[model samples]
Target: MRLTLSNFVNYTSFMKFHYSILCILITFISYSQSVFDQDQVIEKTMSQRWELDDEDKNGTFKLTFYKPIFVLPARWSSNPNELPQSESLENSFTEVQNYDQVEAKFQLSLKTKLIQSFLFGHGDIWLGFTQLANWQVYNDPVSRPFRELNYEPELIVNFPMKVNLFGIDLRMAGLAFNHQSNGRDLPRSRSWNRIMFHAAFEKDNFQLYLKPWIRIESSDKDDNPAISEYIGRMEANAIYNKNKHSIYVIGKNSLDFDKNRGSLEINYLYSVKSNLRLHFQAFTGYGETLIDYNHKQTTLGIGISFIDW
Candidate 1:
């Protein structure tokens, strides 16, 4: 019998000193370089070319990054499917355990044009994973193993249309791919390869985003009986900012596990300088089906990060 335990990551500037505010969680990127990386970033994404803080006024080439991660182990076995009490066939742990994961990613942004206005084409890359259970019995044939890997790419067109919103920003991404090496890598090499299309409405402290997506492959082929397991998906995230942080809630549904699930997260960005900042975040709640199984999970974690904050 084969068992697989998987983990995932969150990448953005929280980890890198470059690319200021980037926190992406997956891969497959096109790489190239140019000048005015900073000014070019604000311009292409804001529909206005920017100059340096003091010297140059031309949008030149620049680089940015986001490297923030939140992971907790011990909690791995604390999943909804865990055997809360000691049973005839199993022994339970005496207490709770804590664990963590690491994440890192970087981006190269340049100014490009679309529809007579300056637009942005950002290339992002990330890598990381969470820690799994260390308990010995977890390896027993009677138990299950889980694991996950995620990657995503997005394309954006930020236009100018503002009066009250977060300065009016809209973006579109091309695709998001997630590969899995479940404890057993069972049935086949299963995963979620999705083609994502989205649009967002942003005004300083508020963001309204909607996404319709589709997943083609998965680990537990028989897990999703009602949804074809590989079809249409939907998700939403709304944010509200007050002072130095943003509070947001997310809802998601799709062909993958935990179809009807919601999440709440808090993002804290503390500024140290005009160009440097620190980021921290926390997550809770559960996903209905993890890796196409009757699984439930609750996650809690803390991370030290760098960003444009």
Candidate 2:
């Protein structure tokens, strides 16, 4: 066949179109593979830890133990307030004024999935519980009494997704009904309930969680009416993992700059063994516990943390 001017023009156009399509396919495939590789890295890294409980396969009930679920012999808080005072009370538990400034802290935290791939195979149901206690073990005058205990329970529905926004991958979103309280009566009691919306984000070795909550009102049984003024309505947590060390920062704010009340907690963890980590934590702010919801304090503590969660 002999080539003409019109035929050569059409041939060039066809080649260009095919080349553009091939470039687009290559780009799409590269993006997909990158996402898949990242997901695999995260899953494998998390699977090696025993402290985390993973969801079961579709249409199954998975009950796994969340470890570092219990931390014993936690020590050090520069200041320990046995009874925190408010404007309503002239003196907060004056009887305990002689309480020791240093005591051991213990915590038990755990969670499990109740249902896997529920709601048209797009969501998961989970139950979680945590308890923290201050023990006067070294204070002989107190007979090693349990000074304070806060209990928390949560019901959560988590939906997983893969969406990238501004270089961050959104992994999951969830709603939770949470209740936290001190199991005490009258003047010593404190409790609150909230409906919270939470979401998870990740970029490289960094992960973040943002949770905002609305308080459920209890007309007659309101223990801490001004709790939100100090504890804030939203919380942000960030974690950075590298090599054998992980650092975490959690911040809460009332969203009112003028009032300016909230707290910040920083935690450092170093892997000491397969599932155990050396944990160092420092906190500055309000709502460290239910009883101290309105109190402001700075504390430092060191303990062992189970890294599986």
Candidate 3:
């Protein structure tokens, strides 16, 4: 059954997820003061990570974290869309297979600076790539095949800024060309391109990112028409870091009130040692993966993630 936003709010499992996050948040807030310096943590982290500050900036190219990279040993889905569908008749699948409800999932992402001070010694050009994959490792009958994999490559021109709005500090802004695809043949191939705008903000130990994109229309028969309705035209990611723990909330919306559709993802990361950390994730909505762009599901995952905010 497709899980709608209205029904998801009352879902027992989703309620449990919400409660767990609430408890975690409360615990973190309680201990936030004695554990870390909020101002330094927030400012230094963002500045160093994005090279927003001109002082001590590296001119040479070097790879860095662009997104969270994690491996989920066990990820459970409430409704696995075994038979994927698409608006394009040629890309729709009718065969339904009995796939395991639990699987292994992982994401690998990295970015590198390509040009420093490209725009009047202000903007820097960067190249980034991210890959997300779902593996049916425990499903022996299926021979442990990969259920889905999405590849995203981007080119961004980022600039540093100092602006404040309603007590929130705007740190940076950028423009990017993004391409995402699942490299598969007809009946499975899914791909899209976008010209996305980026804006980042920070205050205390909280950081927020707003990204809204305009889809690049293709003349070829589109594999997933109207994908924006499910995957969203814009997304916002908010991260709060205190001590060794970080909480992330990501929301995507189609921007249509009449046919409202979107997704929400909550992630908690506890640093175990160095950059390695324990990761927990809960997601409810559509477009969990490129192949499942139009499908809806609720999922929970526990695993290990590398990197710290």
1-309 in candidate 3: lDDT tens per residue? 898986786477556755874584445444443444444332246778888898847775797768887878799999998999998989998889779999988888889999998768988899999999998867867767899999999999899988999999999999999999999998999999999999999998899999999999999889998899999999999999887788999999999999999899999988765445689999999998999899999999998776544
Which candidate tops TM-score? 3
Candidate 3: residue 285 lDDT (0-100)? 96
Overall lDDT per candidate, in order of appearance: 0.34, 0.70, 0.85
Ranking by TM-score: 3, 2, 1
* Candidate 2 residue-wise lDDT, 117-144, digit = tens: 6688778787888888877655756566
Q: Report residue 260 deviation for candidate 2 (angstroms).
A: 1.2
How well is each residue in 118-152 modelled by candidate 1, as lDDT tens digits? 33423222222222222222232423223333232
The TM-score of candidate 1 is: 0.43
By the lDDT metric, which is better: model 1 or model 2? 2
Q: Please give the distance, in angstroms, between residue 165's alpha carbon in candidate 2 and its true position after superposition.
A: 0.8
All models, RMSD in angstroms: 12.9, 24.3, 10.8
Which residue window of length 10 is worst by lDDT in model 3? 34-43
TM-score winner between 2 and 3, please give it.
Answer: 3
